[model samples]
Target: MAVNKVKKVFGCSECGTEFPRWQGQCSGCKAWNSISELRVSSSPQVTRNDKLSGFSGMLESKIRKLSEIEIEELPRLDSSFDELNRVLGGGFVAGSAVLIGGNPGAGKSTLLLQVACNLSLNETILYVTGEESLQQVAMRADRLNLPKKKLNILSETSINKICDISNQLRPKLIIIDSIQVMYLDDLTSSPGSISQVRESASALTQYAKKNNVIIIMVGHVTKDGSIAGPKVLEHCIDASIMLDISDDSRFRILRSHKNRFGAINELGIFAMTEKGMKEVRNPSAIFLTNKNNNTEGSVISVLWEGTRSLLIELQALVDTSASSIPKRISVGLDQNRLNLMIAILHKHGNIQIYDQDVYVNVVGGVKVSETSIDLCLILALVSSLKNKSLPENLVVFGEVGLGGEIRPVSYGQERVREAFKHGFDIAMMPKANLQKNKPDGLKIIYVDKIEDALSKLIDIIS
Candidate 1:
């Protein structure tokens, strides 16, 4: 019998720490119960015959200087959906890996499957699903009623088999239903574990790059809505798309969390229908509803989401509270910002919010992080409390500070243009943003303070 040589190997899978032998705890990384053992091969690893033959073989595989490398820039392939194409900076690039992550039932699969069906013109697409069965995908395809020509579906969980299929099919585009369910036979780790996800993603990414195939991987998210699995999985992808689901099921928004080839903060809006997802051409109209007339505590604000412009409804309500501590609740808008705006109202405008419950919300179930909606929210709260209404066809947008100054928001011109396009007769914005040459046929009301804006709207307020 051959002599067996036992080797002691220690490593922490999470922190990548190596030790002399397996320990209950990893001292280098301070992680308990993370150390694992791996058998070391006694024989030297095999090398290619060319490497054994030395210098001439080395010359053939010599590293090229950076200057000698050809720097050709390849363009991305345009998808049939203009919104998706625009967000991806003109289209999906060959051999690029993309990660799409979102909450459960956030339509990540639906969106990607729609793209596959729409873009299957003359290009072969391989849709591999580990989570769903072949029957489930078939049902979805039947519902979509897509043409049955170029799209192929494979329900697989084995990484090795998937790669083998990819090699045999040589698809132009490949989509993995999810990264969590994929497993490798060589790895001892179970599927969806950190190690398994990382290894599977690395293997798929390497294969895609080598074959010049566009690959999109759907990823499951944590409870906090972040992508599940190790952070390394995200780092390996070329771009990341985050789909946001609102309380209202009518609208779904797609935002780029990371993009190596395109602008970062781009937003795409889609309306979910019985016939899959449909792009919303004019999102402003959908955002601004109940358009018969304007009421108290309602103000229109133009918000910029990347290159697109959206008109948002800012609504606030102030009522007397029965308890000692007034309830302050804000949805889709920051609660701290609402408090600060109330403080400014108390100090500058002599309006008291103490001992009162304040509720603020952005309409259409959309969240607004920008400070530009500050002035509009404050004015809306005041108007609602006083039981007064602003102008019916007027829009307001500006940032409010603790000092009661109205700051100019970015893309003020775009905001005004969007408002005008939506048939608003007048726009109230920061005085600092007034230009010498403004657009024709639109009234501009400039205000330096929140109180100044209120003064201009007093005609309708009374």
Candidate 2:
């Protein structure tokens, strides 16, 4: 009797690159330990299965001419959350796949659950949770003060079961608590594994597109802050929203990393309260503190996140260090850039920061990465070191160069408008940014160099 033989093939879980046998690393995608051993089926594997299937079906099926295909506009479903609607490009588009990612306890589930509850009256909503049990979800729903009716909950980890439920119920909107926890039984890999995440995401994406359903999948981030599992998961989705959690937990910032239907770099602010995540309508009011008087080491800067302008407080501390090597630490701002600015101060302004321990922070636990806040950071540091306070109701923003020249930043008009709306009386910015159609309410002051800005602020300080 002859014995049957079987062959195993190794492939990358991310890019689907196949190898003859099991390997320690994937050469195609340069991912470590991503090679998984898969049983090679008797049928030959086709490289272009998805393309061939889609294209061949299009050709063989009843051919509809371009003009013959019906053109219909689908209205977006209102999420009842203004900030979410704005980030989602005028609300959630039907048949769209949105991937929301954040750290643990960043309120990803809370945000989605609240949205589902809010839309329950008009549309049938399904909330699937793989990470949490039904009791856990129910407790949260109760805390949110959501009504029990019309909101369906399913605590399942199997992707097949979830899809089956989706088909049976045919909900208007579907929310998957997390993609990492969903698993396909056909795949031998464990849940949240690279292979499982990729395969599960692909299946759900296909199901969503075929059924014309709006699906929102929550994903976990890696230790390095990148989305966990395969990169193709992100590519297959329609939009990706990244949530940033502050140490204080009072505020959470939602930013759009990718949007096929809307603008990029859009930001949505939410406050984590007992009632769940509540939208912050007026961020400037909450962000702008210390209205009574101006103090040293604190300066207001108008920063633009997407189309919205936020008034942020930039605070710095410069003091003598006990150690031989003085420390340069920054929170919510780039440390390297802070060091470079200090170097420029030492070189051009005859100020020595090398012997001082410098620290910088953006107030309200918000992160400001734009270079427009550079001038404000420098001025705040200088004022703190000299024990001098800036003038009241004054805000400053500009990009500082190594040669001590001030460079213009984007969306100057929007920043100025926000400053004016926040009752800021004066604005100091780059001279190049002073253009036509200036904002009517505030006093716009432009400067060409760091020295010029300091000179103007010095008079007010005295």
Candidate 3:
């Protein structure tokens, strides 16, 4: 008989990489001062096999050809919100684990509660709250006017008891109000610790996959807006979704960072209302609200997100620098990319803003990550420097290369059509993106080089 023993190890909170002892820097994530100690008991081999069997559902393993396996289509549970479905790559898949992270007041709970109420109408659903009490959840549900008759509520922090209750209930969907507070009895580490978080998430994910249950776990975010806990928690889940509050507190954006069933970097827009979270069907229109016509340094660009296109405004401000080292500040845009765009404008467009305080922003607090906005940003900077406003109804989008060539972006036709639907009169883009038949009311201006685009802009503005 072997005696149980305890061992101490260190792990990185950011990446969940383990080390034999303490280290100043985590080699896995390269994070400094993030290493923490964890004590874990050496359980018997039988205990390990029991957990493994719960995941694999097999006592013995055999090898077979991949082609010999048959494929089956698993139906998804629609959350009744189109935006949420789109971000989730259609809907919640069976036997899938999804992690939703957000700041405290970002409305993560409200969104999930709304979804759970809607989903409970058709299927058996279990709502487990470890952070909030049952009465608190019930009050919120009543305040939101959500249907609560069908949903089953449970308040538990122990993973073992949760699984036990799940076994009896056999709910099709189980929602963990939060993962950080959940603990496993076998682990000596406290809840929310690195060891507890990683193991709890792993166990839940395995249980989800093995039992063909859809489990959506709410996770807390760090100050930096990243999901709190070991990075392995994200890896074990089928999808990692984040809910963020826009610059306008009234709106929220749901983004999918990883998805096994659908596209990555997908975005879903929502509005916080008195009743609950409402999906923003037309995000472009909402983002372009309250526009001041003929404003210098302001331009509209067509951005392609996930499977759709959006018309977003880009604004730039160029002023004489007061300090020797000019400030290069950007809001809702990458700082390094701003620097690169400035360099491109200087070398290719022949505009020198190196001495000026350059500030760029995407209107409406929408963070634009695609490179398609490069030309729009640079042109906005030029418009600001010269104090000449671009056309009020013009939409511009194209990538700028180091060699000064205007490169076409993906889904150019879709972008053009989206812009045209919004009543944009002029569309300035790369020549390569020139379609055979332009929209009825939209004029297409195709430019081959950065200078050509500027010259054509002069032609249009004149």
Number of the top TM-score candidate? 3
lDDT of the candidates, in the order given: 0.79, 0.82, 0.89
Q: What lDDT tens digits, residue by residue, belong to model 3 across residues 251-295?
A: 998999999999998989999999989999999999899678999
lDDT of 2 by residue, 180-255 (tens): 8897766555687666787777777766766778889999998877788778899888899988886557889888
Writing each residue's lDDT as its tens digit, candidate 1 over 315-398 gives 888899999999999999988888898899888888898988988888887878888888888888888898887787788888
Give per-residue lDDT, candidate 3, residue 158.
Answer: 89
TM-score per candidate: 0.84, 0.86, 0.96
Query: How are the candidates ranked when ordered by lDDT, highest leading?
Result: 3, 2, 1
Note the residue pairs that clash in candidate 2. none
Backbone clash tally for model 1? 0
RMSD of each: 5.4, 4.1, 1.8
Q: Give the TM-score (vs. native) of candidate 3.
A: 0.96
Can you give the lDDT of residue 91 in candidate 1?
A: 88
